[model samples]
Target: MSTVVNQTTPHRSGSVAVIGRPNVGKSTLTNALVGAKISIVSNRPQTTRHRLLGIATFAAGKDAPAGQIALVDTPGLHRQQGKFSASAMSKVMNRAARGALEGVDAAMLVIEAGRWDDEDTLAYNVLSDAGIPVLLIVNKIDRLRDKSALLPFLAQVSQGRTFAGVHPVSALKRNGLDALVKELLMLLPEAPPMFGEDEITDRSERFLAGELVREQLMRQLGAELPYATTVEIERFAEDTSLKQGELLRIGAVIWVERESQKAIVIGKGGARLKEIGSKSRLQMERLFGRKVFLETWVRVREGWSDDETALKAFGYE
Candidate 1:
C-alpha cells in the first residue's frame, strides 16, 4: 500500500477595515480577533491616533476555515465637535479612518449593542460609502440585562441598511466570534495569507512602545488632558550586556500642549509620572515578552495637536 499525504491551502485572506465611533470597542474587537493587544485600549474617546494593522490568522478549525485577516485598525470616525474634534489632530484621525477603507475587501462597522446614535450612523455611512461589503458587528452584547431585547436591537439597526452579515458579539468576553469569523471568511475570495501565521501586527516594537505609553497617559491623566497628549519614543535600543536576558531600553516623551498640563502629569512629587512609567513598562514587557527599562518625561509642545508640522514630528498619522 502507498502512503498518502494531504495538504490544505487557506481558502480566504484579505484586508478588513474596523471603523466606528469613538469608545465603541473597535480596538478591543481588533485585539480580540487578533489574539493580541497590538492596539491599545482606554476609556477615553480617540485613544487611537494612528492607523495600525493587526494580523489575525485562524487555522482551519472545525467551524471555521483556514485564513488570514489583515485587520486595518484605524481611529474612530465621528462628526467633528467639542474640543478634541476641533483640532488638526481630529482631522488627522478622521482622515486616517477614511483613508483606511481604500483597497480593502470588507469593513466591520462595530457598535455597542442596543445603541445606534448619530455617530453610529455616521460610521455606517462612511463604511457604506466605501463600496465594500460591510459586516455589522453588534459588540458589547454581554452587557445587556435583557437578552431578549437583543433581537429587537439588531432588527432596529439592520433596517434600511445593506449589511452583508450581522453578528452579535461581546468582544470583551470573546463570545460569538467563531461564527463571525466563519461568515467573514466566506465573503472573501480564495487567496493566500497576507502575512506570516506567527505575525500578529505590522507595527514595529518602537511604535508599539510609544502607543503603550500613550495608553497609560490616556488612562491615568485627567479627562481633558489625555486628549492633548501624545507619546513619542525618543529612544529604543536593546541592551544585551546583562546575563539575565536581553533588555529593551526605551525613552518616551509625553508631549502636552501647555505647561500646566505638564505639571499635572508629573503629579505631586513625580508620583504620577512614576506610576505611568511603571505601568507602561509592565505592559511592554508582557506584550514583547522581554524585560524593559522605560524612562519617561513630560514636556510641553505648545499647540502640537493643532500644528501640522508638530503633529508630523510627534508621529501622529
Candidate 2:
C-alpha cells in the first residue's frame, strides 16, 4: 500500500536569529536576503549593537508555500574580560543578542568562509544549545581563491552539529542566496505572513539615519575612530509644506567618549565632519527617496561607552 502525504498548508512565517562572531558578514547576509540595507556594515568588529530585524517575504511557487522569514541581525558573540571600558557595552550587546535568539523558531549561525575561530565556537555553542533548528551560513565565499576548498571546510564544520542545512554564500555578490533562502523557507514554521510583502525592515527612518551617519564615520575615519564614535538623531522633521526640493530636515550629534576623539572626528578645519555629513545626507536622501537637509554636531560624552546609565540613554541598552 502506498502512503499519502498532505499538502494543504500554503504559508510559512517565523523568526530566525542571525548570530555570529564579529565581522563575519551577518549584517551583509541580512541585507542581501531582505534586498535592502537594513543593518549597517563595517569592517570593524562588534559594529552591530542592536537586535535588528529584516523581514524577507518569499512568494509561493508551484512546489512550496509562501513564507516570511524575520531575520534578526544581532551583535557578535565574543569573550570579554576585565573591567575595561568596552566591557559594559559588550555585556549589554551580548544580552541583546541572547534575547534575540530566545523564542525564535530557527537560527542562522553566520561564519566567515574557510575560517573558524574561538568566537565562532562560542557562537556555535550558544546556537546549538538553543534546541532550535540551526542553519549554518558560511558567508564571504567569494573571498576564497580556491573554490574546491569549500566542501571540506563545510564538512569539517558540520561534523557534530545538528544543523538543518548548510549553505555557502557570498552575500556581497548575491551568490547562492536563492538556494539558501529556499532552505530557510523550508525550515520556517507554517503560519500567516507576519508583515506586508513590500515591507523590508522593522527599523524606523530615524534609526536608519543615525546608522547611516555612523557608517560613513566608520568608513571615512577607518581605524582612528570606529570604536569611539556613536551617532544620535537629535531631531528628524518632515516638511509637509511641499516647498521646493527639501522634504526632510535631520539634526544629529556624533558622540565621542572623550574631547580628543571629538577633535579627531571634526578633523582639520571641520572638513572631515563636513565630508561625513555630506555622505550621510546623500545616503539619507536615497533611503527616504526625498531631499534631505542634514546637520551634524560632534560632542564629547565622557565615558559613555562604559557608563551603564549613559549607554542606556544612548539606546545601546
Candidate 3:
C-alpha cells in the first residue's frame, strides 16, 4: 500500500508574537485563534507569566488560504518600577516578553476596546521597535453597547503608528476571529508548517495543568489574593499500576510570599483551598481526558516574588 498526500498551493507559515498590556485579553485571543485553551485566562492582571506558543492552522478552502500561524502568547509588557511593582518578577516577565518577539515573523498588539493608557503605549512602542509587522488588535468589543464607538476607537489608536493591519474582535465571544486569522495568514511568510496539523500548542500537559491551577486561584480569590499566589507542579505521572482506565497523578504546591497570605489562601476551615483544588482537578481531567488524583499543598516562601533565587526555582528565567 502507498500513502498519498494531497498537494495544495504554497502554504504560508510563521510565528506571530501576541503582545499587550496586562489584562488586555491577549491570552483569550491566542486561545480563540488556536481553538483551544493553551493559555489560561483570568480577570486579574499579569496572569500570564511565561511565553506560550499556540498553533493555528488554516485549512485550504475556496475562500480561504492555507497557512499555519504559531502564535506566541507573551506576558504583558509594562513599565515596572517605583514602590508598587515586584521588581525581580517584573524584570523576568519583561525579559520573557521581549525574547518572544525577537524572532517572530509578525506581532499583534492587543488593546482593550475604548481604552488605551500609558501601559498600552509602552506595549505599542516595544512591538514597534521589534521591526516586524505589527497588527493592531482591538479586543473586548463585545463589552461595548454602542457598536458605532468601535470605528472611532480604532481610528484613534491607528494614529502616529503604522500598523500592518487593524482588527476589532471580541475574543470571549469568538467574534471577528475569522477575518483576523485571514489577515494574520497574509502576514506570515511562505514556509512549511512548524508543527503537526493536529497539534494546538507547544506546551506540555504539566505546564498547562499548573496554569489551570493558578487560573482557579485567580478566579476564586477574586481581586484580593491572586497576585500573591503561584502554582508549581511538583510531580505529574501516570499510575500504570491501575488495571482499569489510566489515572494521572499530579502534586502541586501553591506558593505564597508570607504566612498570612498562606492562611488567607487556605481560608477558614480549609474551605477555600478545597474549592480551588476541586476546580483545578476538574479542569485537569478535562484537559488530560482521564481520571486525575490531584494533591495540592500551600507553602509559604517569604518574598519569593522579589527574590531572584526563588524566582529562578519557580521557573522564571
User: Of models 1 and 3, which has the larger TM-score?
Assistant: 1
Best by lDDT: 1
Screening candidate 3 with a backbone cut-off below 3 angstroms (N, C-alpha, C), the clashing residue pairs are none
Tens-digit per-residue lDDT, 268-300, candidate 3: 999999999999999988877899999999999
TM-score of each: 0.95, 0.93, 0.95
Count of backbone collisions within predicted model 1: 0
Predicted structure 3, TM vs. truth? 0.95
Model 1: residue 120 alpha-carbon error in angstroms: 1.0
Pairwise lDDT winner, candidates 1 and 3 = 1
| Tens-digit per-residue lDDT, 1-317, candidate 1 | 01122145446899999999989899999999999899999989888889999998877765556788899999999898888688998999999999999999999999999889999999998887789999999999999899999999899889899999999999999998888888888777799887888999989999999999889889987485867888889899888677545799999999888899998899999999999999999999999999999999988878888988888888777
- By descending TM-score, how would the candidates be arranged? 1, 3, 2
Ranking the candidates on lDDT from highest down gives 1, 3, 2
Q: Candidate 1: TM-score? A: 0.95
State in Å the error of residue 199, model 3.
1.4
